[model samples]
Every structure is written in structure tokens, then in C-alpha cells.
Target: MHDSTQSRRTARNSLLIMVCTLLSRLLGIIKARVLGSVFGATAIADVINFTFNIPNNFRKLFAEGAVNAALIPAFSSLLGRNEKHRCVRLFALLCTFQSLLLIPLVLVSYFYGDGLIAFLSDFDANQVRLGGRLLPFFMVYLATISLASIFNGVLQAHENFLHAYLSPLLFSICVIFGVWFLSDRYGAMSMAYSVLGGGLLQGSYSYLMVRRYEYRFKPMLRPQNAPFKEVLVAWALVSLGMGMQIITQMVSFLFASHLSEGSVTAFTNSTIFYQTPYGIFFNAISAVSLPLMSRAAASNNAPLLRTYTRNSLLSLLALLLPSSIILFFLSRESVSVVLQTGNYTLADATLTALVLRPYLVFMVFSAWYALMLRLGYSANRHALMTRIVFLQNLLDIALMWVFLKLGLDIVSLPLANGIAYTLGLFILFFLLRDLFPLTKEARFFKGLLRIVLANLPVLAFCIFYKNLGLQWHESGSSFANLAYLMLIGSAALGIMLLSYKIARIPLLSLLRSKKHGGNLQGDNLIHLD
Candidate 1:
């Protein structure tokens, strides 16, 4: 009964996070559309993308990836033991340490911004100068977001996911306002300033939310803080591992930089579209599952851990498979409607679609990889996770190098990423087999197979709809394109629903129950805990 209650809570929290994520992503898409319309795939676009990459990547490393991985599990463990004072002390230490650490880093980045930009991308003199000019503004985000990450960790430890996830919405709103009001006068630099604004707002909001949960910030650096020391050790391993993943993206940027004038923009734009659904569904599941899995691991509850992991995988596959199919069939049309306006041209959209196609092909593998990494963290397998990420990045870089050598150009980058992630997913599953024996779960596999098989009709309908020669972007009318997309999308969804009904899948019911605030039975849905 406790497990059932936890499962429902997980579901509820996951849904809340999903809604928040969806809104943030929607706003993000709007922001991207604004940028695309204003700048298209020009050198200005490339410069903006490249300049922001450094700070944004670091944000992922410190704020999102490593810090969260190391801090959340430890914080959750402390809270599980009812060690509120200790947790608060550790939180204060982390904020101070990260603040001191980031200040020097940001200072160096500001001073040597030009050299750093040149090293990351082989931009020409003008573009390099623009990047140097923009780097300092963007670098401020590193500090703001890093602090925000700590506050986020505190909120997640308390299971306050709504505010933690919703906080990003402020960032998007600020950027949109910047683009709308400031872009005309400041040009591309307006976006950089907007990033700083967004970061400040995001960090402030997260800090306030944490304080509401009784977490007061005190500046203290105690060397003997055992929990802080433990977090540092784990953080080092997690950062190194996750840092390599970010490096893979940096490598791709380098590769794209060497391509044509607009290649970097094309690559970045495609990535944004691909990550939208991924962020919405896969990330939401992982975020909500982490604290629960951490508690299970702390208590040495292997059964509970495995249950959470398996259910997350099942839910991911069920949702992501259909999303992948939809993206595959409509990559071009989707790109056309969303980004092919203003300064962005049909040619640019075509290039972006080419990149999105192969990226979406491996969406399921990417989702699996994310879930497995979270499980690794929950199980306190940071060393193993580090090794896996290192190997994955190594393989991806090698494949990318090979593709470039073969003269495959920009599309090769995403293809390499997809292949590498696929390899990593299989390897992770094999390593996790002992703790989470997926093959023995015949019912889970059966349902998964049904979900996959059930997607066939949806795929068929999409293909048929495409063959009907319906152009979503015809007549240069946004409404017509959106209407056409909805018509086809609704049909595809209906076919998927019908197929699931025939196959006795309970996804719709689970969603319905979740929507109606009804208790979900373990037997009715794949039990997650």
C-alpha cells in the first residue's frame, strides 16, 4: 500500500513537472522562432549560438548535470534521516563555494573571451570579434544559474518540483521580451543581454522558493563538513562524466564551425527542435524519479529501485516511440511551420530538417540513456556512470571525425551522436542487468512490444497522409500550415489510440486516472514502485 501511494505521488509529481516543462519548452520554441525569423542562418545567428554555447554548456555542467546528480541524492538521503540542520548547513556551504569558484572562472572567461571563442569555433575575424564582445554578458549566466542549481536541488529534495521546474519560465519570458524590444536597436547582442536578465530572474526565483521551504543561506566554508565533503567527491566524478557529454556538443560546434557560414545555426536549430519533446517527457520522468530512487538506494531497497527504473523505462518507451515516429514523418513540415519565417528561408529549413531526421531516429535510445544515467546516480554508481559517459563521448567523437573525413558534412554530427548513444544504452543495460534484470520481466517486455507493434498503424496513416500531397506550408499561410498539421496530427493520434485499444494497452487509462486524481492500481498499470 505504501508502494502504491508512492507510485501515485510519483505520477502526480511527474505530471506537474511535465506541465511546467511543456510551458517552458513552448516559450523556448517561441524564443527560438523569434531568433530564427530575425537572424536566419546567418553569421549573426552563428555568432549568437557559438557565444552562448560556452555559458549554457557550463550551466548544464554545474547547474543541471553534475551538481544535481551529486547534490540531490545526498540531500535526499539527509532529509530521509531527518537531518534538516545538516542539510541546511551543507546547502549554505555549497552556495558559498560555488560562488567563489565561479567568480574567478567568470573573470578569466571575460578577459580571455576572444581566445576561448576562437578555440571553440573557427570563426572569421568579424564573427570572432562579435563572440568576444558578447561573451562577458553571457558569462554572467554561469554564476546566476549555478546558484540557481543549488536552490533547485533544495527544492527537489523537498519534492517541490513545481517551482523548481516553473522557474525556467522566467528565463524564457525575459529572453522573449529582450528579443521583441531590444533586438531592433542592439541587434544580436540584445539576446546576450537578455540571457543575463533571464539568469538573474531564474536564480532569484529559485532562491525565494528555497527560502520558503525554510532553507536559509549562510556563507560558511567548513572543511570538516562531512556531507559537503561527500558531495564534493561525488560531484567531481559526476562533473567529469557529465562534462565529457557536454564536450561532445562542443566538438560538434567545432565541426559545424568549420563548415559553411550558416552551418552552426542549422545544427543548433535542429538540436532545439529534437530536444523539445525529449525535455518534456524523458526529462520530466527522470527528474521526478531521482529523489525516490535515491531514497530506495539509501535504504538498500533493491526491489524498489528496480521497480522505479523499469516503470520509468516503460513509460519512456511508450511515449517516446510515438513521438519519434511523429517527428520522423513530419520533420520538414514541423521545421517549416515553426522556424521558416522572417529571415529564415526554405533552404535553411531544408537543411535543418536533414539534421533533425537522423537526430529523431535515435530519440528512444537517447531517452533510455538519460534514464539509465539517473538510475546509475541513484544506485551511487557515479564511477561506473563516469566510465560509461567517457566511453560514449569517445565513440561519438571518433564517429564524428570519421564522418567529417568521409566528407559527410553537418548531418554527420547528429548521426554520430545517435549511433554513440545507441551503443551506450546497450552497454548501460548490460551493466545494470544484475540490479535490474529486465529480461525476466516478461509482462513489461510484452507490453513494450505491443506498444511498438501498435505504432505501425500510426506510421501507416502518416505515410498515407504524406502521400496525399497535403502541404502544410502551402500558400505561405501560417494558419493553413498549422491547420493542416493539426488535421494530420489528430489523425495520427486517433490511429495510435485505436491501435493501443486493440492491443489492450492502458496508457490512455493511466493518463485519464492521473487527470481525474484517482488512485492508480498497480495491476492496472505497470507498477513503478
Candidate 2:
């Protein structure tokens, strides 16, 4: 009965986060369209991409990735122990300390922004100088979003996901309006200022939500506080692990910057396309399951922890496999319809699509790695996760180096990322064998095989439909191409649903259980044990 209830809660939370994330991603896609139309794939776009990448990468490291990984598990454990007051205190302390820490960092960034931009990007001196002027504005996000992440972590610990996810949409909206209205006058600097504005709004909204949840902010900074100490200990390892991953990405982008003129822009654009579906689906599940898994681990409920871990992985594979296939087969059409407007030319679309195609190959592995890292965190295995991430980064750098040596150019970046993630997924599975074995009754490989097999018809239909003499580029109109692609995609989806139904795959059944309150244990297609 408890298992059933927990499953329902996980589904509910996942649904809430997923819906908001889908909406946000949709808005973000529009934002990307606006960026592509206004900026095109030019040196200005490359400058903006590289400038934004630095602070945004740190935001992930300090705010989203490390802080959440360390804080959420500890917060959840505190809640499990009925230590609400300490949790609140720890929250305030984190906020205060992060604020104090960011002030000096922001100042340093302002002073050294030029050298930092030049070091990270391969742009010429003039462009790098312009990007340096923009870096400080983006650097402000490091403070704003880091504080917001603490509020978000608190909300997630309390299972209040709605506000936490919706707050980011404001960031996207502000950037869109900034680019639309101010880009002509102030150029990319307007967009940089808009990012700062968005971060402020997002952080403020998160702070309000924290207050609404009855956690008053008293601005405490207690270095010796036990809970704070615990968070710091976990945080160091988690940050190191996540920092390695983010650094690997920065290195890849650095390589892209050195490639062709618009290689950085193309790479960034293609990554946004890949991340849309990933954030909407895979990330939503991981976010919801992490706290539950932490609670299970705190109580030493190994069975429940294993169940959550397995279900999350299977769910990821079930969705990611089909999505990847579609993206891989229809990369060009997808990129064209979404981004081909105004300054973005046909060559730009073709280049982005080329980078996107191989990137989709390991989308499932990316999702799996995300979930596994959360699983490791839940079990307080941060040191192990750090080791895995460091090794993964090493592997990624080695692969990218090899590809560059072979003269692969810009495409080598995403290809290297995909290959490294695939290798990392295997490494993580073996590393987490003691906490959550992959060979349990919910056999990971067997279930993955089922998902892939069920997707075969959909893949076949997409191929057959594409060969029917309809070409996106030659279709003469974007609307016409979009209509045809939608038609074919809908049919492919229908075929996938039918295949799942005929095969009694567990994906749909799990979703149905969420709505109907049915027992997933009785769904013979899945092994819960």
C-alpha cells in the first residue's frame, strides 16, 4: 500500500514538473527562434554564446547541480527525522553564505572578465573584448540563481514543485522581450542586461515561494552548524562531480569556438534542441524521484529505493528511445522549421541539423546518467559519483582531442559528448551495483530491448514516410514543411502507441496507473521486484 502511494506521488510530482517544464521549453524554443532570427549564426552570436556559457555553466555547478544534489538529500533526510526547524535554519544559512560568497566572486569576475572570456573562447581580440564587457552582466546570474536554487531545493524537499519549475519561465520571457525590443539599439548587451533582469525576477519569485511555505528568511550564517556542515561536506563532493561535467562541456564549446565562424553558435543551438525534450521528460522524472529516493535511503528502505531507481531508469529509456529515433531521423526538418527565419540561413540550419543528428544518438545515455547521479546522491555516495564524473570528463576530453586530430571539426564536439556519455552510463551502472543492481527482476537491458523493439515500427514508418518524395528544404514554404512534418510525426506517434499496446509495454500502463489509481504491480508487463 505504501509502495502504491509512493508511486502515485512520484507520478503526480513528475507530471506537475513535466507539464511546467514542457511549457517553459516551448517558450524557450520560441526564444531560440527569436535569437536565431535576430542574431543569425554570426560572430556576434558566437560571442553571446561563449559569454553566456561561462556564468550559465557556473550556475549549473554552484546553483543547480551541486547545491541541489547536496542540499536536497540532506534536506529530505532532515524532514524524515522531523527536524523542520533545523532545515529552515540550514536554508537561511545557505542563502546568507551563498550571498556573501557571491559578492566577492562577482567583483572579481567584473575585474577579470576580459581575461576569462579570452581564455574560455577562441574569438578574436575585438570580439573577445566585447564578450568580456557582457560577461559581468551574465555573471550576476551566478548570485541570483544560486540563491534561487536554495529556495527551489527547499520547495522540492517539501514536494512543492509547481512554483520551483515555473519560476524559470520568467527568465526566458525576459530574455525574449529583451532581444525583441532592445537588440537593435544596444545589440547583444541588451540581451545580457535582460538575463540579469530575468535572474532577479526568478530569484525573487523563488524567495517569495519559500516564504509562502512558512520558512522565514532571517539571514543566518552559521559555518559550524551541524546541518550546514553536513551540506558543505556533501556539497564539496557533489560540486566537484558536477563541476567536472560542466567543465567538460565548456571545453567542448571551447573547441567549437576554435572551429568555424559559427561553430559555437551552431553547437549551442543544436544543444538547445536536444535539451528541450530531455528537460521536459528525463529531468522531470529525475527531479521528482530524487527526494523520494533520498527518503527511502534515509529510512534504510532498500527495496523502495531500488524500486524508484529502476522505475525511473525504465521510464527514461521508454520515452528517450523513441524521441531520439524521431530526432535523429528528422533532424533537418526539425531544425529548419524551428529555426530557419530572418538572419538564420539555409547553411545555418543544415549545420545545426548535422550536429544535432549524432548528438541524439546517445540521448538515452544522457538521461540515464542524470538519473544515476541522483541515485548516487540519494545514497550519500557523492565521492563515488565524483570519481565517475572525473573519469567521464577525462574520457570526453580524450575523445574530443582524437576527433579534432582526425579533422572532424565542429561535428566532433557533439559526437565526442555522445560517445563519452555512453561510456559514462556503463561506468555508472557498474559503480552503483551495490546500492541498485541493474540485473534485478526489472532487468535494465531486457526492458531497454523491449522499448527499442517496440519503437521499430515507428522508426520504419518515419523512414518510409520520408522517402515519399516530400522534402522539407524543397517544400517552398516553411508552413508547408511544418504541416507535412507534423502529419508524419503524428502518424509515427500513433504507430508507436499501437505498438506499445500490442506488446503490452509498461510505459503506457505506468502512465495509466497515475490517472486511474490502478495497481502497477498487476501490470504483468513490468516486474516491480
Candidate 3:
């Protein structure tokens, strides 16, 4: 009964995140169109994307990803034990430590920002100089959002998710309105200023949310505190993994710089599109999974842990597999409809689509891999997580070097990303197979096989849809391109759901399935049959 209640709660949270993520991503698409229309996928766009992304990468390494990975589990455990006071102290300590570290980072970016930008990007002298001016604003954003994530993690630990998704949505809105209203006046510089404003707003909202929850700021810095030490231990390991990610991102920028003019913009925007579905599906699940998994692992319940792991994987693959397949097949039309307006030309869209197709593989497998890491975090398996992240990053760089040398041009970026993630996924499967109860359930494999079978026809429909759309009109009008997308997308989704129904797969139940709740509620899931 408790598990069932948890399931409903998680469903409501996931539903909230999905709705907000959908809105934010759509606004994000509009932001892309504005940037493309106003700036095109040229040196300016490349510079803006690269410069901003560099600090955002640091934000992942130092702030949100690292903090959430460490803080969420500890927070969940503390809250579960009715130790809210200790949790607040832990939060304050982490914030102090983070401030101490991030202060130096912000200072470096301000003082030596251009040199850092130059090192991270391989742009020409002119582009480098232009990008240097924008780095400070993005770095400030990095600092603000990083700090806000502390409170964001607090909300997630409580399963009160007002701040987690809103920050990015605010960021996107700032970019869209700033570009639309101020582009003619302040030009691209207006976008930079808006980013600074967005970051302030993000920090503000998080602060307000914490206050509303009746949590006050109690700053305590005690390095010898065991909870603080434990989180530091986990955070250090997580930061190592995120550092590798940061390194790979920087290297990719360098690679993009050498590829061609505007290659950085293509690479960056392709990544944004790849994240659209991932944020919708896995982000919400992971949000709920981490807290519950932490509670289970803290109780040392192996069976429950395994169940959560297995079910999360099932939920991910159930929706992700079909979506990825269709999106992979429809990458071109999808890119055109979303980004091919204004300065984002047919040629530009084609370049981005080429990159986005292979990247779809990363989008799928990385979500699976991320769930495993969260499992590791919950179970306090930091060393193993470290090694897995290392292997993934190592393979990515090695494959990227090999692919670029093969002269695959800009497409080599995502191609290597796809291949590395695919390989790392198998390695994870081998290493973590014991944690998955698949062999215990013979029918699991059968269901997965059925899902694979279902995706086949979805694949066929996507291909047929693609060929059919080509006969009507390929480009020239965004409306025609969007209509083409709507037709194919609606059909592909219907086919996927219907196919799952024929196979007796409760797709909606999977969506709402909590860590301990796998059974269905009639009201919670759609009755497909």
C-alpha cells in the first residue's frame, strides 16, 4: 500500500516535469529559430554556443550534476530518518564548500576568460575574440545556477519539484525574448545580457522555494562532520566523472573548431535536439528514482534495489526505443521543421541532421547508462561508477580521434559519440548484470523481444513516411515541413502504442511505475485494448 502511494506521487511528479520539460523544450526550439534567423549557423552562432556551453559544462562538473548526485541520496536518507535539522546543516556545509570552490572559478573566468575560451575552442582569432566577450556572462550564469541547484536538490529530496525544471525554462525564455525583442537593438550582446538575467532569476526562484518550504539558511562549515565527509567522498568521485565529461566536451569543441566554419553551432544545436526527448522521459524518472533508490539501498534491501533498477530500465527502453527509432529515421524532417527557418538553411539543417542521427544512439544508451550511475550513487558504489565513466570518456575521445582522421567531417562528432556509448552500454551490462533481475524473470526477455518486434514496423512506417513526404515538398516553407513532421510523428506514435497494446505491454503503467510499485492502477494507466 505504501509502494502504491509512492507510485502515484512519483507519477504526479513525473507528469509535472514532463509538462514543464515539453514547454521548455518547445520554447528552446523557438530560441534556436531566433538564433538561427538572427545570427545563422555561422561564426557568431558558433561562438555564442561554444562560449556559453563551456561554462555550462563546468556547471555540470562543479555544481548541479555533482551536487545532485551526492546531495540527493544523503538528503533522502536524512529526511527519511526524520533528521531535517541535520539535513539542513549538511546542505549549508555543502553550500559553503561549493562557494569556496566556485568563487575561484568565477574569478578565473573573469580575469583570464579569453585565454580559457581560446583553449577550449579552436575558433579563428576573430571568432575567439567575439566569444571571449560572452564568456563572463555565461560564467556568471554558471555560478548562479550552480548555487540554485543546492536548493533544487532540496526540493527533489522532498519530491517538491518547483525549481529543478523551472531554471532551464527560465533560461530558454530569456534567450527567446531577448533575441526577439533586443536583437535589433543590442544584437547578439543582448542574448548575453539576458543569460545573466536568467541566471539571477533562477537563483531567486530557488531561494523563494526554500523559504516557502520553511527552510532557513543555516550556514555551518564543519569539515570533520561525517555526513559532510561522506558526501564529499561521493561528490569527489562524481566530480571526477563529470570532469571527464567536461574534458570530452572541451575536446569536442576543439574538434569542431577544426572541422569547418559553423561546425560548433551545428554540433551544439544537434545536442540540444537530442536532449529533447531524453529530458522528457528519463529526466523525470531519474528524478523520482534516485530518492527511492537511496532509501532502498540505505535499508540494504537488495531485492528492492534490483526491482527499481530493472523497472527503471524497462520504463526507459519502453518509451525510448520506439521514440529513438522513429526520430533516427526522421532526423532530417525533424531538424527542418524545428530549426530550418530564417538563417538556418536547408543546408544547415542537413548538416545538423547528419550529426543528430548518430547522436540519437547516445541519447538512448546514455540514459540507460545514467540510470546505472544513479544506482551506483544510491548504493554508494562510487569507485565502480568512476571506472565506467572513465571507460566511456576514453572510448569517446579515442573514437572521435579515429573518426575525424578518417575525414568524416562534422558528422564524425556524433558518430563517435554513438559508437562509444553503444560500447560502454555493453560493458555496463556485463558489469552490472548481477544487479538486474532479468534472468529471474524469463518473461522479461520475451517482453523485450516483443518490443523489438514492435519497433520494426514503427521503423518501416518512419521510412515510408519519410519517402512519402519527399514526394510532396522537401523545403522552402516551414509550414509544409512542420506538416510533414506532424503527419509522420502522429502515425509513428500511434503505431508504437498500438503495437505495444497488441503485445500486452502497459506502457502508461511503465511511465508511472515507482521504484517499489510495478503493478497497475486502472485510473493511472490508459486501457489501450
Per-candidate total of colliding backbone pairs: 0, 0, 0
As for lDDT, the candidate ahead, 2 or 3, is: 2
Write one digit per residue (lDDT tens) for candidate 3, span 384-442.
88888898998899889998899998888788887787887777767766665445745
lDDT of 1 by residue, 1-529 (tens): 6645765766777788778988987897689878888888899999998788778777777778788999999888788777788888898889989988889887887799888888889899989889998888888887988999899988998888888988889999999888789988999888888998999999999999999977877778885544887788889999898778777878899999999877898999998888888988876778877887788778777766776676677778777888889888888888888777767887888788899889889998888887888888877788898899999999999999999999999988999999999999989989988767777766557657767898999888878877887664633328778787777778888888788777666552222122112222333444454
Name model 3 segments beyond 4 Å from true: 32-54, 105-138, 178-193, 212-214, 223-226, 253-269, 340-351, 361-363, 403-412, 441-443, 466-469, 511-529
Cα shift from native, residue 366, model 2 (Å): 2.1
lDDT of 2 by residue, 1-529 (tens): 6645645665667778878988887887789889988998899998988788778777766788789899999888888778887887888788788878888878977899889877877889989889888888887977898889999999998888888898988989998998899999999888888899999999999999989867866777665544787788889888888777777877988888788887888998898889888888876777877887788789887766776777677778777788888888777778778778767777888899899988788888888887888899998888888888898789889999999999998888888888888888888888888778776644545666777788999889878866775565533238878887787678877888888877667553332222121223334333232
Per-model root-mean-square deviation over C-alphas: 4.2, 4.1, 4.2
Estimate the lDDT of model 3: 0.77
Give the clashing pairs for model 1: none
TM-score of 2: 0.85
RMSD in angstroms between candidate 3 and the native structure over all alpha carbons: 4.2
Clash pairs (backbone) in predicted model 3: none
Off by over 4 Å in 1: 1-8, 33-51, 106-137, 178-194, 223-225, 254-266, 341-351, 403-411, 467-477, 501-523, 527-529
| Model 3 / residue 481 / CA error / Å | 2.8
Error of 1 at 249 (Å): 2.2
Q: What is the TM-score of each candidate against the true structure?
A: 0.85, 0.85, 0.84
**lDDT, model 2, position 92:** 76
